[model samples]
Target: MADDLGDEWWESQPAAAGSPGVLAANANSSDALCGPSKTWIWTELNQRASSLQKPSGDEEGRDTEMMQQDTAPVPEPSQETKQPMECFLTQAKETKEETRKTKKWKKKKISEILAKSEPKPGTPGDLQQLIKDHYSGSRSVIELEELNLPDSCFLKANDLTHSLSSYLKEICPKWVKLRKTHSEKKSVLMLIMCSSAVRALELIRSLTAFKGDAKVMKLFAKHIKVREQVKFLENRVIHLGVGTPGRIKELVKQDGLNLNPLKFLVFDWNWRDQKLRRMMDIPEIRKEVFELLDMGVFSLCKSESLKLGLF
Candidate 1:
């Protein structure tokens, strides 16, 4: 029965040579049957896939060229071109340093100039010599004028008088006691010293002790009585002259007078002369005289004393 069924199936299958189904199956299987055809199909598929996947050698080469162009080297600046800039910077630095140094030097010089400058005549020692000479009876009126004091001398002279007067008032009792008990010769010497001191004091007073705005003439008038006495005493000594020391000694013994009066008298006489006046009027001389008077009478009087001993 199986053999009979097999025989029936075989009869139902069509023959391969003339059947359309058989032809269609053969065409579908042609790639597997032909090696060259299969190889050609694979090569064409790979070519198309590679074209879609990545860049070719030509495109890669173009990309490489662009990268190289982007990274091109820039030239460095030449030393010759940079030299001028460097030099200019150096020169500017040096110029600033030099300017700083110059300013420092100028400041130093100015400080030195000011430091070395002289003090004004109104300061100490201004009238030291004038006071000394006036008291010691050594300086003549001409010599006083020649001294060329500053205006400050007069101001200081006034100060000296005020100071001395205060001192005298404080010691007046002692002076009076000394006057009464002392030998005539000793008394005379003391008196001379005292009188000279007082005259110096008076000179200073005359200069500084006045009220404001008075005329020179009126001022002179105010002190006229004492001034005349001073003048008279000065004239007496001048008339006696230095050669008449004996006469001067006798006169001192008799009158308790001192050489101070003569000295001041001489100074005044010389000072008041037209010639001395003209000289004193000169700005330079006037300044000098003022300075001399400001040094204080006591200081100048001491100097005159030394000169007197020498003479």
Candidate 2:
């Protein structure tokens, strides 16, 4: 059966044209904790391909004729024909000018988006203010619930002074000593939470410099099952775990994840998805994240053992 399906069989089958394939793919990509996540690159590629597409023969033929008329003198025509030809030339020139302006505007918009994508360092105070602003317009009574916690719960900002590996060393100076002394097989010393499995995977790759000999596991719900994660946690001495909020919440609820051993809880806080929305901006994900914090991390905050980092 595996041989028959061949490679790439498990990937999502793209829907037919005129279908909601792009929208559907984007929706799943955002909540990829439970499924494979695809990037918005496909949509970008499609848009590029469309822009590069050659105009139809009708339009091309008109352009060619217009060029020839402009370059070569034509025999004098009747008054009626001359007026329409002049109008046609004027319309064509206007269309060309409009197209040029459209392209220029698009380029400017793309640059603006790229600039906005850059990660800016923020203090714990900034994070608190952002939370307050996000919920300031509480239209309903239920939305009035306080999501922001005390300032002591948050660690200092990354400050862009060091690479992720070096930052980890600076923050957790005794990591080497703790790693050796830790004996729990079912708990992680550090847990990094992100918005999606795709980001989690990226974080795992970045951990190469920091992980060293310590075991790092991806705890998202993409291809792995809850039971499988439970077994891995029970059998292996995991030092780090990277996952999304929903799956992490589920694991903790099932007693598969132990927060007692967690010393550092990092949020992939500054990163934004293609839609320019942060993890907390997404309604479902925001709820799960707050819920996860309420589960056990809030209690751990009282002790000096657990420190929260906004990465």
Candidate 3:
């Protein structure tokens, strides 16, 4: 019975050489047999792997594009959005207009070039310029000519004495003689204008009472603020004011120094410093002098009441 079964199985397994199962089995047995047949399977595997990598490459390309879009420079801000720039341009235009307007200023006529020395009776500035020009010359010295100063309480001295007090005595001989009669402290009846506070102090030192207390106060713009000066003048009974023209002008403007009752206005006329500069020689101080003159000094002087002396 076993021999009959084995024979039947062998008979059932056909010996056909063209069968697909037998060919596949034989191809896997040897490289020579399987070389070309295995090509299809390897080609299929490579195609599947390449397809998978293609999706990743596409995803990477998209990521790079998004990064480029984010990192790209944005356009400049619009005109409406640049408010500060617009304001700056507007300011520049306005400034240019102002400069153009200022360029149209007329040339100032030389005050001395004209035959007549007198200034036109117009604005205060014109009068101020005239006064400045008159004193600007190197030989611009106020002489003791009676024609120049008539019926005034002022006196012209040749030169300052050894000391300031000596000089005062020489100028105000009658005042010194009669001052003993007055019991009240002599308020500042005289304003001594000088170039600097140091000079003012030097002049004040000369005003010291030979036999009594030297009641002298300084009034210069140097080292002192304007408000503080006003306060000092307001509170104290200053007998003599010795200061620069600038501070003197400030005082008169602020009404700190009363020029109404002022009798003697002494100026350091001939006393030139090492630079040969008198009070009028300096520009700032000269301008200040003009300002003081404008502030009722010249008006008072026109009445010939307030005396102007060349110290």
TM-scores of the candidates are: 0.23, 0.57, 0.47
lDDT, candidate 1, 1-311, per-residue tens: 65867677754565444345544554576656767776675465456556756789999999999999999887887766557888999999999999999888874433355368831212234334534454447667776565543433222222222343343333232433433343322112111111122233443444332212211111121233434433445343221121112223343434534433222211221112222232223444444334433433334444453111110
TM-score of 1: 0.23
Of the candidates shown, which would achieve the greatest TM-score relative to the real structure? Answer: 2
lDDT ranking, high to low: 2, 3, 1
lDDT of 3 by residue, 77-192 (tens): 77765578889999999999998888777563444333356322222233334565655563244421211323354454534333455656666666643334433232356678
Enumerate residue pairs that collide in model 3.
Answer: 165-206, 188-238, 188-239
- In model 3, state the lDDT of residue 216: 54
lDDT of each residue in 201-298, candidate 2, tens digit only: 88888878777788889989998999999998988888888999999999999998889889999877767788767786688888787678768776
Which regions in candidate 1 have their CA more than 4 angstroms from the true location?
A: 1-62, 69-71, 75-164, 167-286, 290-311
Candidate 3 whole-model C-alpha lDDT, 0 to 1 = 0.62
Instruction: Single out the weakest 10-residue window by summed lDDT for candidate 2.
Output: 33-42
